[model samples]
Target chain A: MNDPGRRLPSGSEPVPDPADGPTDGPAGGLTGARSSDRTRAAILRAARAHFARHGYERTTIRAVAADAAIDASMVMRYFGSKENLFDAALTIDLRLPDLAAVARDDLPRVLVRHFLDRWEGDPADDALLLLLRSAVTHERAAERMREIFAEQVAPALGEAVDPRRAGLVSAQLLGLALTRYLLRAPGVTALTPDEVTELYAPALAAVLS
Target chain B: MNDPGRRLPSGSEPVPDPADGPTDGPAGGLTGARSSDRTRAAILRAARAHFARHGYERTTIRAVAADAAIDASMVMRYFGSKENLFDAALTIDLRLPDLAAVARDDLPRVLVRHFLDRWEGDPADDALLLLLRSAVTHERAAERMREIFAEQVAPALGEAVDPRRAGLVSAQLLGLALTRYLLRAPGVTALTPDEVTELYAPALAAVLS
Candidate 1:
């Protein structure tokens, strides 16, 4: 298993390294591979955690490196810079379920459940939380929000509904999260989950109807 | 007009200088009252502009003072701190129009027009813009967003609809702003004014119905 002639997983298609490269040394030439994977994963994990807790401006590469038990130079070598690390760490494709497949009548209920599950499912979505928090102050964060909604939610709405109306419906759905969840506005935060679902379900259905 | 002995607009108020050993100049005096008034107004104007552009964290009292053409000490003396300045600058009670008085069928159109007017009415509502931009990164800013929704929106909705269902109804309405106006999510942003009214009116009405 110690053949140095093997290839490593570089996160994409494996291109043949030059003959002098480490791939041709033996069959399992992964002496540096496992450590590299661990280092990359650790940096990503720490970046997510730090970005969640501190927001973008406050997160430092040195701190992320400390959190990952790696050198700062290693982080730069891997991700180029703190900004790149953040971009990579937070680049989540919100794989929303197919909106067209759900019965229009059940759209609100389904949408609400999907959002709750997504937020409640992962603690690592701290970047999302941080982004939500920063959206209040940062234009770039707002632009990201616009991009996610436009690219992810809009396309899923299908072509039946007029595009303008479709966009408005999507806006309303995301706005609930912005105001109720992110802002924690008083009455909004006071509602039980069940109440939110019951009330919004019909409203959501009507948007499509 | 530069009478040192002139009293404030309030004909009977006391004016005392701390440097003068706290001796009351008169039962009602205006000593430097005009200057103080001008300073207060200038601070509010500068703060609103600064808060709109830079938001809470990035905005500084020093910058605000510079914008107002006053000393930094004057800003501190009037508003105490940046927080106080922000509070004073944004002490707006959003006076939403009466929804219950409108015909049920016309609710969406009315709501659309109202929101459009309110947002376009005041450029000083930079706090709203800031919240839209930075809600993803700052807790305090996000909290302010919640507070605005809860205090202004929830009360209006609770009065018009079933109090129990108001939160959900409120969420949809607020969500409209978040997606359409703030984030400018694609489909939502593309809707014409009349089309937005058509799509969301029923959804809004459904919350109360």
Candidate 2:
């Protein structure tokens, strides 16, 4: 579900400078709040890396905590059990662009480019790949994956095509991601990012139109 | 990498039926050969089903033997070991149509139709699905999958397009199979086969052309 190799930012929470004391006033409260947020974000990033690399059954909260450089007890206190941690870590935002705003013909190229960028932008940080890897074996992950596609992707492509057709578009795009990134199927991986976009854009365009 | 659930024909090698002596003539030899072939096929089928359902790590020789209704010794005697049995069972024949013979414009529709028919034809008997399920976790299975795509699929489509483009085509098609069949992603699986064909064929056509 998550890969452990990716490094999380050091120092789970930013420490307040000794010079800035309680006399620092309202800024102190904001800094404290921000520190808690940073800790949570760090835990989540570490958790995702573990899940992406090891999968649901094998990934342990302790390992995630170790990777995040936090105490295991802190992880448990913040996220409860491993399952809860996984649920928190894998909250995906596809961030599908608004198709309505783009020219109809430009949709396919836009969509392909966006996905290629997402996948190439960062391999270890990609939550979608985590879900894809885990969904194959874990029932909960599979359900989450289904929910993401149905709720986020389908709505984003609304009225550009029928719901069913939109689903097909998703299948095509996801397939490319699975082969290129997750499976590293040689042929698919051999192509440069631009080459992939060149080859896939038209096919996606056909689907969109 | 292989499942034991799909039935292989019984008998890995032909044995002369005890009822028919070697002296019984050519007819006796033919019947014995056919029986052995059937047994071998039965064992392979069972192996595929088991691997597909349980994955490489969990699938066992005894379970495959039990599913085939053959003695454990017989399973070993035929396929040697669990790993060897897996290799034997998952030898896929995609039976990709002769693309060179097909009209270039019709290639996409033909290719999509063939795969849809193959997947929908018999979910239980499909070796491809077994390989796909196993490939995610098992390095050996994953390697086999890569080899199959590179050797069988890439070569089949070679004359029609560049090898790199053929690989991209494989990614798209395999991705569809991954989401719809393996992950059972809600949106992709909901479509009827015809609906899928309608949506996917054009995209594939664009790739092929």
Candidate 3:
């Protein structure tokens, strides 16, 4: 039920009609960059949905292309191979709140709240679930997860606390995602976000300290 | 290298030769039950390795049979399908400590340590990781995980704690397994089991309380 129109990259491109699909035809010259960008975004959106549902190993280029309403060759031309496509599909910006700016006492609560908001905010669009879901199924996806922890998570929290335990923080958050979002475990999914914050924020604070 | 001899069902039946493979011939009469058990166990072990590495959606009956030293037909004959095989492969007993017998103050620590022991005791043999790893890729595996949480984890801890929070406790523990065991996140994997208990047990206790 995804709107292809809404999946377009935010830019100066002339927005295509919602019913026309991506762009009218093969792109060229002035419209080429815009058309390609829209195509890539559409492909990434489809790819993330597949990876989230089918996981890294089972998700196929053909399936992703079919979902994107493009030819399989187009997906290949843009993203190269399945592995590269996977990497492109799940490149997430955690948009971690500026931890350095938070009051020292507020860091744990803020971090926990930010994560919950990010996961619950727009689940269908978030690539983190796709990454986590695929991580267990493929080594490359797992490595990508490790990279996100090292690059995004660690640096984001490093100034406020011992960066090393960022992995632990990620573990707690990812585990919650695994249960609440992906597995939809009854007890976990049943909790409201406020309840999650009340119950989980403390554990995150404990790990940080 | 798995020894088929070691995989046999523990019973009065004579063990097979590791050198000779599973058994001498088609089992009938008295050896039937034992032979079948050995074959099933062998299949499960291979299936776990595959599920651990490949995720559920991608693991095939053919591949599992090849690894188990049997014909693909035999695997189907016993397990019926990939989904059934996945169910059989990942059926884990958390072997929770007797929470009812422990002092109330020690419940959290005891539970955390038991999970660590279970995970680290014989990692190759532990199906919990396999279950978690595959749970995201397929609905059946995810349901199986939910089943384990409901049946095994909730009941085991129901006596000492509010059983409903069992899912939260499981979330924390499962998160640790995701980063430390499955993803092998360096910061987390570097922690000694005691350190994990020290850092994480507090969160679980907080959730429980």
Ranking by TM-score: 2, 3, 1
Q: Which lDDT tens digits does candidate 3 get at residues A88-107?
A: 86677777777777876787
Measured with C-alpha atoms, the lDDT of residue A160 in candidate 3 is: 52
lDDT of each: 0.61, 0.71, 0.72
TM-score of each candidate structure, all chains considered together: 0.75, 0.82, 0.79
The TM-scores that each candidate's chain B achieves against the reference are: 0.67, 0.82, 0.80
Residues B1-209, model 2: lDDT tens digits: 22222222233333322212232345555576565665676677778777776676688989888877889898888888998988876677777888778887877878888887667654333477777766766668778888888888888875648877787788778878877777676667777777778888899888877
Model 3 chain B: lowest-lDDT 10 consecutive positions:
B2-11
Task: Tell me the tens digit of each residue's lDDT in model 3 across B17-100.
Answer: 232134455546438666776787677777777777666656788888887889999999988988788778767777677788
Please give the lDDT score at residue A137 for candidate 2: 70
- Chain B TM-score of candidate 1 stands at 0.67
Point out the higher-scoring one by lDDT: 2 or 3.
Answer: 3
**Predicted structure with the largest DockQ when compared to the true one:** 2
RMSD of candidate 2 to true structure, Å? 7.4
Comparison by DockQ, 1 against 2, better one = 2
Give per-residue lDDT, candidate 2, residue B9.
29
What total of clashing residue pairs does each candidate reach? Answer: 41, 46, 0
